[model samples]
Target: MLGVTDYGAFVIAFLLLLAIPGPGNFALITATGKGGIKGGLAATCGVILGDQVLMWLAVAGVATLLAAYPAAFHVVQWAGAAYLAWLGLRMLLSKPGGAPRTTRMDSGQYLRQTMMITLLNPKAIMFYMAFFPLFVDPVHHQGMITFAFMAVTVAALTLLYGLVAVLLTHHLAERMRASPKMANLLERLAGACLVGFGIKLAAMR
Candidate 1:
């Protein structure tokens, strides 16, 4: 429907991709853990907005430009990796017994931060560009309708995944509140993972 072929397969593939642990998921879980459900939701919205922007850019053929310019692609990749590493380092080095970082951030800040995180990752743009065409029926393409459907599907799935991550992380946060040490440890671990992701992104060719 909507000029998309194998809708079921598309949904399954998309969900599987989402399920993979990535910087986006890490940000969601970390935000929720630090800022509670409200913070988590704000981050989620930011990510969704970022994804929409990237998808549209892909549709506009930015992906071709990226592929044409290896240097440009590497620039974005390095920037994204650096950004993730910076965030991870901050969390990793944070001293315990202080106010949580989430407490200091308003909704707007969370939104902006997460949006930047999503936008800086060039891999996401590549993924959308590569994956979107596979499901699009060129012969039956209905322009806006097909694009809109795909956009909405991604947004909906992201929302569901974000909500689940927020709930689960919030639960864990609640338990961790009673033990500062454990909370600190978990935060450090999350930070480490973020750093690892940054390193991985940097290593990607």
Candidate 2:
């Protein structure tokens, strides 16, 4: 069982990570901006689920496989990067050209995109590699417990960020109905970030 110190340290680390602006936060914000609270929540769920699955895989030795087979990691990294860039480009090019529509994404689509967004993030893999090991204690046999704690922490933070996205997007969308300038800018910035991140991931030694 994790003690008070373990929980405290975990909270601090989780908050610090949550505060960072990354793919997950970007997705949440974008989704909410487009679809309001429901969309934001959908994306948030996807991120939390993906994070947990990756965390478990890491604990179960996938991280070791990644370390041993650097080529495979690069493949996944590049693929993820490409996907992120594509999404970013789509956002950059989107316009209110068609019949303007507003609706929350369906469950299947939301889950699929959310998973894609989270899994394609090479930084997330690195994050798990660096963060998960910090709490592991060989003497404690607390691997599963620690993983669960981390998963919950991520879920909580994702939900919090999702709410923020929903609120912010709701306001932004209302104010800027026909304007694509801001969306295009954000999409381009996100795409650039993803491309850069991809190159970094591919080049990691």
Candidate 3:
């Protein structure tokens, strides 16, 4: 319906994309670990908002512009990579038993920070531009309706994923709170992953 072909396939593809480890996931988990459910939900909202913006930009042909301008794409890619790497390094160097700086931020700050992270990644824009078209039939396209449906679908799935992540991370955080050493180790691990993702993004063509 809504001029979307293979709706089931779209859901599956979106879910798979969400499951991939990335800066967004790292931010969600870290926020939950520090600020509990409230922080996690705030970050979730930020991600959803950012994704909607990117998806619509794709629909508006921003992706094509980026493709035509390699320099612009590279600039965004490098900025995203640098941001991730910097955050990771800060976390890695944080004193043991200290909470991640992200956790220290209030809810509004958390939302904005996550939104920025979500918006910075050029890969996400590319994914939306490529992925959305696969399920959109140009001949039967309902224009805004089709785009709206896809946007709603993405938001719903992302909320579900974020809810689950928040719950799980919060649970772990509670347990870790009892053991400072364990919490520190987990934070360090998350930091290392973010660093690795940053490096990978920077190296992407």
For residues 1-205, could you state the per-residue lDDT of candidate 1 as single tens digits?
Answer: 9999899999999989888988888888888877889989999999999999999999898888999999999999999999999989988988887765656887777888889889988988888989998999988989989999999999998899888888888988898889988888888888899999999999999
Judge candidate 3 against the unseen true structure and give its global Cα lDDT, from 0 to 1.
0.89
Candidate 3 on 13-64: residue-level lDDT in tens?
Answer: 9999899988999988988887899999999999999999899988888899
Per-candidate TM-scores read: 0.95, 0.80, 0.95
Name the regions of candidate 1 deviating beyond 4 angstroms.
none
Among residues 3 or more apart in sequence or in different chains, the pairs in candidate 3 whose N, CA or C atoms overlap within 3 Å are none
Overall lDDT per candidate, in order of appearance: 0.89, 0.68, 0.89
Q: Which parts of model 2 have CA positions greater than 4 angstroms off?
A: 1-4, 96-107, 137-141, 178-205
- How many residue pairs clash per model? 0, 0, 0
lDDT of 1 at 49: 95
Residue 183, model 3: Cα distance from true site in angstroms: 0.4
Model 1: clashing residue pairs?
Answer: none
Clashing pairs in 2: none
